[model samples]
Target: MAEKEPPGTTVVIHGGNYGPSSQQVVCPNCHNRVYTVVKAEVSRRTHIIVILLCVFLCWPCALIPYCIDSCKNKNHYCPSCGSYLGTYYN
Candidate 1:
């Protein structure tokens, strides 16, 4: 069993650093009603590799990755706290 914290204790909890994007979401970190800091749908690891393929293999081949699903993901985060809420696949 752990000891209880004193009455006047200040605990600072912080979140992670997600990409730059403005979105509205409830911040679990600060417990704010809602935070607007949605990030843009960023590319995935596979997408980068495929993009390289487009450059190396063929320039036009780059479009191939865009046409396919799972090539990118939409990341949602809290604007106020920057906590990762979830990811939406497009």
Candidate 2:
């Protein structure tokens, strides 16, 4: 069964399977097969890396740089291939 979030409450999805469940496709920018989350621990580690990078860079610039893009959608998609890049949370 799927999980649920309460109304007017914030929740964090620790890890889950996402993206196209088929052969990997190349990223337009990097031209690399996107990595899949085979293990929840691995995904958590990657999430930490991204958050740390954003905090290090954006925190110096401003407190909420990621929020600019996140306000629209949770995950940002590529206009060219329509691939799920990642979520934008600030």
Candidate 3:
């Protein structure tokens, strides 16, 4: 069963699997239909991978994780109101 949120609390529930791309969604803040704008950010996991690659493998290859979208987190925002919606973790 799916989890539920507490009463009087606002939550941004995603319809499907979100990715590093723009998608159509209903803005909870603005109460309007709009497309989401995605921004890629380096996460802790990416930092760990970079460190491991540099220590175990090579320093040059350590940058690979930073260049890959799957190694980062995608932050979703409502274009209409610019409210933070959610984050897509890889």
Candidate-wise lDDT, in order: 0.58, 0.41, 0.83
- Pairs in clash, predicted candidate 1: 21-38, 21-39, 22-37, 22-38, 23-37, 23-38
Better structure of 2 and 3 per lDDT:
3
Which residue window of length 10 is worst by lDDT in model 3? 8-17
lDDT of 3 at 42: 97
Candidate 1 lDDT over residue span 17-82, tens digit each: 333444344467678755445544547765786779877977767676666544666566666677
User: What TM-score quantifies how close candidate 2 is to the native fold?
Assistant: 0.22
Tell me the lDDT of candidate 2. Answer: 0.41
Q: Which structure is stronger by lDDT: 1 or 2?
A: 1
Better of 1 and 3 by lDDT: 3
Q: List the residue pairs that clash in candidate 3.
A: none
Q: Write the per-residue lDDT of candidate 2 for residues 1-90, one digit (tens) a residue.
A: 986867865332223323322223345455555442221122343445557767778545343333333223244344445655554333
| TM match of model 1 to true structure | 0.44
User: Candidate 2 regions off by >4 Å?
Assistant: 1-73
Q: In candidate 3, residue 56 scores what lDDT?
A: 92
Better of 1 and 2 by TM-score: 1
